[model samples]
Target: MKLLFFVPLLVVALVASTFAQQASWRPVDTKILSPWAAEIDPANPHPEYPRPQMTREDWVNLNGLWNYALAPKGAGMPEAYAGEILVPFAIESALSGVGKTVGKDQELWYFREIEIDRSLRREKLLLHFGAVDWEAEVFVNGQSVGTHQGGYDPFYFDISEALQSGKTQSLAIRVWDPTDEGPQPRGKQVNEPRGIWYTPVTGIWQTVWLEAVPEHHIRSLKNTPDFDNKQIRVQADVAGATAGQRLRIRLLADGTPVGEQLVANQEEAVFMLDAPQVWSPENPFLYDLEVALMDGKKVVDQVNGYTALRKISTARDANGIQRMLLNNEFVFQYGPLDQGWWPDGLYTAPTEEALLFDIEKTLDMGFNMIRKHVKVEPARWYYHCDRMGVLVWQDMPSGDMGNRWESRPGVIGKGTEKDRTPESEAIFRKEWKAIMDANYNFPSIVVWVPFNEAWGQFDTEEIVEWTVDYDPSRLVNGASGGNYTLKGQIMDMHNYPDPVMPDPQIWGDQQVIVLGEYGGLGLPVDGHTWQEKDNWGYQSFKNETELQERYSRLIQDLKPLIPKGLSAAIYTQTTDVEVEVNGLMTYDREVIKFDPAFLRNKHQELYTIKIPMK
Candidate 1:
């Protein structure tokens, strides 16, 4: 990862200012105003524990400011330094302190210094990036440590060997992201921001930190809840350990130990509670977990975690119609279409508090569910959802569509569908499997959406079956909006500016009716928009009163459809993106747009109405 180069001092100073300008060193009008906003001290911002699910009291927080520079395509390391840009925000975002675009050609370089604690000399130190858009190369004190690709997944590298004692450790990173120009699994990020698409997020857009662990440490763990069997399956993947290492796992409920077991390296163990407490929106009970690596009688490494009890499946209701069952009963689902975006940070939130605020607002809006559209959030996000009692329907991020012409909409209602190439199909399948494997343990995620609006959609039947086989405990939405084959459990439809119900005849016997997306009421408040002109929505209104009136009307229209078998409905979105102004909240999350009281009343009305099975 080492790059050798030289740059004139004048050129370095010029580039430093340019980087700072692009990173939005001057605050914009649309910046989110929170109580904690002014307290973001570069020295101690986001000091809260990063991983809520797997808690370790001994770990350190390595967030805050970092030195940054933008290099031209194929440029080597610069001799001089650039100004400081906030760590974890993309260069294209306002919060990054650099709002410049990192195109397919250029590379974004980041350099930071960290002082290692003197007491942890014998421990192995690992550098972790929650996520870096596309690809990243790491260097520790001028020595190459590792490199990683894939934008939505977390990766780490052990840099203990590259460290020197009694000196500040210098960490350097080089990132290259093609975004929409490449065939990577980037969700909705495009070089040119447009309707429903967003500005490209390049370089580190998530938390970056360093952790010190023993030679034999807990690498990863998975918790799967089986409500029907009344057992939880726990799998541990220990790293830097010997083959015969024994790991002890203890399951606790309300701080009381329920079950304990010992397993060998990289093995799965089942722990049964005396009386399992099933997880649901009404009662979200999580069992505290503690796992320790042992060498005979001594504990080598330990980590704390938690798990919830829940079950998701399709079963016959009292009226014999297929419905989504949670904890063995039918519960109508309703939520917003969450497209994880921020005006300041783009992919990353300004801080962990900001991230939690979005989830909290979604719950406060009186909805119990959310369709996580195409983007995978950090583990902490899902942990918040689990703790806040919000159900999640996770979607696999779409891939490249080789035949763009065939995928584009032709007439007002007609569309072209083409057969996918074998290579494209194989790639899609591989990535989809990886996504499911990575997020399978979360109890809040009940449904797996394989395709959305027919993006790279092929072999629908096969993919749906594959999803079921990969994780049979959850429901499957074969296709979210269009090109439905009636293969999945939910018969989902999409309508904008108005609500629509699926044709019962096409989904009469097997599927439960659900409005996957509808009601995009947009109002772009001045000074809070990404761009002034061409700010569009599915249905735009001039003022908050009009938006609220239209929203209430839409809900009133959906009332009769409940009796006609509408089981669930997800409104257009939670917040607006770059040019798409249709959001309940503004892009910066500064304004709620509509009256909260009216919206909450409408939400309560929607939830209270019982759908007839017939």
Candidate 2:
């Protein structure tokens, strides 16, 4: 990926003073904080290029300090903002500089002066948001540009027309997030926080930036890998595409050209690769991708990306028991029910390093997979997983989740689906598809989890059927620990403290058996607790030694179950969230109760187990 830097001399001289301007800004007091919190510089918080999967050389970062205020939902823009709130951090977060909640009746407003370098704003200037909670309406220099809904997916507005003829432009955004009050896809967020639910995250919680592209530019890319055919299929979208427009796609392995293709705009391009290295936990080889829009001979737009070859499916074993297969081989997937959260930032991590730390620590502790529990992370998180060889079971964040997990002997989890209004259903459908579309390119994601534990589980058969129809490339976990109709490729069961699998004697031949959740062993370190007193966990231990001993026994109990039919298993979580202390690491991420070497060595055996065949 190429990142071209061209900082003018005048701007270079003022860069040093930017940090000093925010010297007084400090993270509000929290019960605990990650090590990265202390190192945050407001001038360039989360300075890393946000969209690693889609990289452009010339772009301006629109992060840092921004004036913000809370107003009544129906009220117009505030006459005056109370103070500066950090962009990309939720207003309810300690890192946001204004730790306050914006309930369903209120709307959060943000205003910031954006400096658009005339040189960088060539033909088109687009404002990009990694994500904004609930709904957001954008205004450039007080001119309404566009409005976007859905809190977890990325969106942008073409602000080129709204730009004023001035050195700096005014940017304002009005956001309304209902958290649990509204029927949106807000995962694990509640106004009244306790037990499994945490504090509400309102307004912007991810990177906001600016990009420069030609009039006719590549808007998005969806690359699907055909492992059986040894080819990659691409569906590209170009904004302002005109007649005679063509897209050039080139593939490279270690800088050596592998293949190239030129196709007309809006056409799918299939590039061949002979015997490419397959991506897996063992070898996560990524090939460079160069894409460009060609107007005659000259390149109108270009963006750099990467991809890999991988496949996921299920096959029956000799004993007529279905098993999960990755790249045509049976490898047991075991990982944590990773609830991505931070004590300081809540839904947002303090820094990119803080985000990468969770993935790195998960791998260090010997897990190859992570069930991104009921949450969608920033693009960079998936990019890290793709590069680091960590398999992801991406969950659609649960919302409108009051339905009971009702089921009978058979008949597609009958009487369990929620009778949601059409608006709620549409919101779920639109957001789920957007999330899938946004994250489809990453090979790390092997399974798509539509509903979790019957929360917002509606139209089970239709939803699962549609998911399979939409993208047949990956397996679908119909309802992870939810109302399982046995329609998807996986039949997951939720067990606590002890590991268990769906009985192979009965349901083993129909779908891949898995322990969707188990092993919630908790040991909260003193001084690192989210609160002073009560904390929650499925099983609590007094000391580190006791926690480690019980975890070892849990794994000892989990291994033999794989031979019967268990395809995969997910532990409770990666880190302690709020009062739930079941994580391997503490909420502050200051301590790991188990030794990494011992844990990894113990887990390594489960991957080698094989079921007997017919």
Candidate 3:
């Protein structure tokens, strides 16, 4: 496996006075608020450490209130900030306190006071942003630090040189996101949101922090688990690496070292575990890892992380239909289409607690998997899934829609693929690869979905081939609910209201057959909706009993297809998003339309349905 990555800029220790300064900032009023909305403290928004897979002891959380201004596109640093917009929350979101839209015509400008503690001044200071939509240019003490593009990937800059005479330095940022106007991967965001489309999220929507690291440190870590062979592959990208430097790795089970190895810098280390414990949804297990950068016997730098052993592939059954296998066995994956959106925060969740709520509720409903629909979540989201045992089908956030797709689900690529401009195609490829590279280590992500519903889908075969070549450990869903092509390991089709499967006889031989989406039974709870007048679902019901009956019927309609070779099924959604009420839960996450116990009971049966074996 290749670690196509960059120097990961991360966060620093949140000292006392920095958080206490943000007490006055507050979220603006919103139509619907999640239960965790009230708990948001502007002084310490998303206080949890941003990166979980790789652990660092020291970092500053730059998430509190920041001075902001919306200036004309191609504008320079603002002379005066309009107001304080909470860091990590998009300007369009209520949590930002400035619920205004910034488009192609304008840039979102942010300025804040950053104080690097006197103790950490000697080391290299790295600035990290969890994600900034579209494009971002940063400055320190009025000097240009760096610029980054692509909306959904983590990026950073080394600001050690930009520091001034004192600990207090001025940080300024200029961001431009065109949303629907440009060909960038904006996912469901639209200039004007309605139905499935959502509000634009301009500027930073994830964590912003700073870290101090030694000259020689791990830039990034890549671990690949081969469950079938009972071995794991590990490699590290090191900063300030020299020819004589070495890498030491210790793999532990229950904190007890099982294997240790030393390899030259940039060399892959393969550690074979004696009877490795397989990680699965039933028993999600993880091995602790300690890695060190060494110059001979002297330890230069080290970090703590973890890895899981799991394999995702396709296998044949008795009838010769390919099944989606986990560790060489069919698990019959089933889950909901999880669009990670919040009414108050839009692109950013109100809090880390709120961020984990959807995942926790997903498991409560007995969902074995979740199709993270056209949105790349924070690293912690995938980290939570890895620990809690849920399979993730990660999507490349869709953009440049209006491309024509095949008219019928049975048809495979009757329409021409979209012809994107050179700039547009490059953005898609760069962001997709970066999204994969940044998230390659999480074992919970079993599949990589490049296109959703044919939105921004170009060079289908070539792109799918690149994805497979990039990471062969996970299965690839060529185009979920999009124009099907004779590529990738899985063929996915979308249907509404009723659970219908593409005839296994037609698609099973070439790819693993699955229903990407079905069963959208909507019932809008009165006060818990984004809007009261125009609530919608594929199949709408008036009452709880009616919704339950319709949903149960849909599940019953899907069970028989599993035995007939439907390898997986994803329901329409996890929660109501904006005006789309076709979710098991309401948009605010205040109400579960149906009892979780009842839904879990019906879903468990789908996993038990056995297919014919040869």
Instruction: Show the colliding residue pairs in model 2.
Output: 318-613, 318-614, 319-614
Q: Which window of ten consecutive residues has the lowest lDDT sum in model 3?
A: 2-11
Which has the higher TM-score value, candidate number 1 or candidate number 2? Answer: 2
What tens-digit string does per-residue lDDT give for candidate 2 at 112-169?
Answer: 9977888767799889999999899999999999999999999999899999897799
TM accuracy, model 3: 0.95
lDDT of 3 by residue, 465-530 (tens): 899989999999988878778789998888877877777898888899988988888887777788
Error of 3 at 97 (Å): 0.8
- RMSD of model 1 against the true structure: 7.4
List candidate 2 segments past 4 Å from native.
Answer: 1-21, 406-415, 612-614
Error of 1 at 445 (Å): 1.5
* RMSD per model, one decimal: 7.4, 5.9, 6.5
Give the alpha carbon lDDT tens digit for every residue of 298-379 in model 1. 9999899999889887765445656677887668788999989876667776677888888888877788899999898887
TM-scores across all candidates?
0.88, 0.95, 0.95
Error of 3 at 441 (Å): 0.2
A best-first ranking of the candidates according to their TM-score comes to 3, 2, 1
lDDT of each: 0.75, 0.86, 0.86
Report residue 23 deviation for candidate 2 (angstroms). 3.6
